[model samples]
Target: MTLVPPVTAAFTLEQSCFGKLRHSIRAFAGSFRPPQALSLRTAAHPSTSSVIVGFEASTWLRSPINALHSIPGRHVTIAFRTEVSDDGELSAWDVQSRKGQYDKVLNALWEMDLRELRVLRIDGLRWWGDQKQLFQERAYPFPPTQDDEAPLFARAWNVEVLILTARSDVSLLEALTELPAARNKLLFPRLHTIAMEWPRHESVSRSIVVDLFQKRHAAGLPVRTFQVLRKGGQDERWEDLLGFTQVVVHDSASE
Candidate 1:
């Protein structure tokens, strides 16, 4: 009703629009405030309390393992997987490359401080290339070599749980039996659980399992649980023969 200058009228309208816009923005932002109960729930969850670091062979070269040192956690498990072939066969050149990769990973682990490492699991393709098939074709036994760095790394870290799974022409049983007596007696001294996954077609005798446990005991390794997991059916007969209270057979299909 009062006469006002044209500029004053326009400025008042602009200021009113800006004020409304700011108020709306503030209300929208406030709506997103997280509930206090959600924060408490996240703090209490078990999975949230632990940290896991995983590595794949393809990406391992690009990433630095030392970055794990900065993560905060009371427990940590390092899981690594290596794939050797596009078709499950390693060529002559591939063998050298694979060995180099393995050595690099071993060296990294050895150099790192792993006081919080609770478990280590590695799954990979056969390391032996076509040598096993070649030996069988020529009617000769394939000689297996023990991994020197693996035991030393496990012993140094004092890993509590260890799991190894690889599909190769070489039998895991044979490799375990072939472990040098000197190293076998000292490897995995703090290991509480050991799990091995052999190929589905492989057949391991009950005596081999018993011998493995006996060797571990002799080595002063405090192993309390031993598990052999395979992908097929299970036979309860081994339970009676194993005689060890900690031995258990798991069928991977069911679990």
Candidate 2:
């Protein structure tokens, strides 16, 4: 039997009102708003298939909030920037602040009633901090503790494909581990494909992709598929991607 392609759609929201944006998208696609909770089976329409969301610009704190939670959809993808500055110099406040933001988003998504979730993607990240001056930095850093990234999507209805790109920090490797839950858990127990792309030589990224696969397999979530794509910022295949996905990546290079 030919596998049916899942229904997919993309979403982009501004930074200022991402909180509301999250609720809006969920209400629109999910068939219920924040103040309400509905079963995915009941909410899904005859036309409902699969949807994918992408954030082109950096929402910073807002990005995590929008992504951490699992929506009652077919698929979801989240991407962010990852470029660390002064490798060894990192700070405590930076780590905590970034983790805190992600925590907020995850906490919210965790509260939803997701049922048909399939694919999940987190990408375009940059890590910049100094170990010696971690606390003195004004901007918060990301990929907090390797432990913090795992709890975001412990239960994703029926996720099948997973993808990660441009992640300079290895902390996300933990994202693959399924959080043990009560019986009849709706988590991604049948995930099939996993894809991740990072800067070629960044040991952090290399170690992460390796560890992610190993750990998930050890945990009985053996990955059935895998793909790695190098992210080269704008020079990367933005146009090719647009053509491939039939979604315009926008010609901003000249602007």
Candidate 3:
């Protein structure tokens, strides 16, 4: 579905006593604004239509339930970003903190009302830390294992598009390999599109990419579109890739 440009609204106060009062009111109202990175849109008409919500930088800090409650729609696409430090080095504490924050958001998502959400796009996740240590320490933020049944974003039956963008191929591999043992039973049953992004220069072998989709298919996910996005490169031949009927490669100069 085509997404409309995000709509923004603003209010200004005049330079007068009443304006000062209005300014105060606005300030008070602003305090109640949705948490950072959360954006909601309601339909202009009364018809039962879809809505779109966007969460940008550092979305894991806030709960999305409250913002979602105010909107009504049959189909919703939640676009969000997870930001990690881009610095060259990271402490163990930094990794742990990132994991904790991500888990918090994951748990919140699992508990949220997803009766209308149809798509979830993690537009981008920046990880500048030690990749090996990150995965070794914690599970990927979605589809909590049977050990933790409550944080199940992957189990949401309504979700169709699951787009995950990572900073590197290792990060993507870590996410896929860290899935629970009973992954097939705990997978995205209704997911139709699985898109992943990473740098082109990252040393991701074709086998790794192929194996990821193979695992998804083995898990009973009827994913129809398999997309790969890289910073710069011609589309690679993915005809040999199993699982998805369509494989798309995208190159972005500015990625």
Q: How do the predictions measure up, each by TM-score?
A: 0.42, 0.43, 0.46
Q: How accurate locally is residue 60 in candidate 1, as Cα lDDT from 0 to 100?
A: 21
Model 3, span 159-247: residue lDDT tens: 55555434224344434434533344433466566556543445655667677667666666546776666545554677767445477
Worst 10-residue lDDT window for candidate 1 reads 35-44
Where in model 2 is the C-alpha error above 4 Å?
1-15, 18-22, 29-113, 124-152, 178-187, 198-201, 230-255
TM-score of 3: 0.46
1-255 per-residue lDDT for model 1 (tens digits)? 322233212111111111223232222112332111000000101111111332211222122121112221221232223335687677988766655443333323222334444554433222342221211111112222353223323233345555543322223333333343334444345666656653344455445656666666554544677666654464545453243437656665544
Q: Give the clashing pairs for model 1.
A: none
- Candidate 2 or 1, higher lDDT: 2
Best by lDDT: 3
Q: Quick one: how many clashes does candidate 3 have?
A: 0
TM-score of 2: 0.43
* TM-score, cand. 1: 0.42
* Tens digit per residue, CA lDDT, model 2, 18-51: 2432453453334242212121110112111122
Weakest 10 consecutive residues, lDDT, candidate 3? 41-50
Model 1 regions lying over 4 Å from their true place: 1-109, 125-157, 166-185, 197-200, 203-207, 218-222, 239-243, 253-255
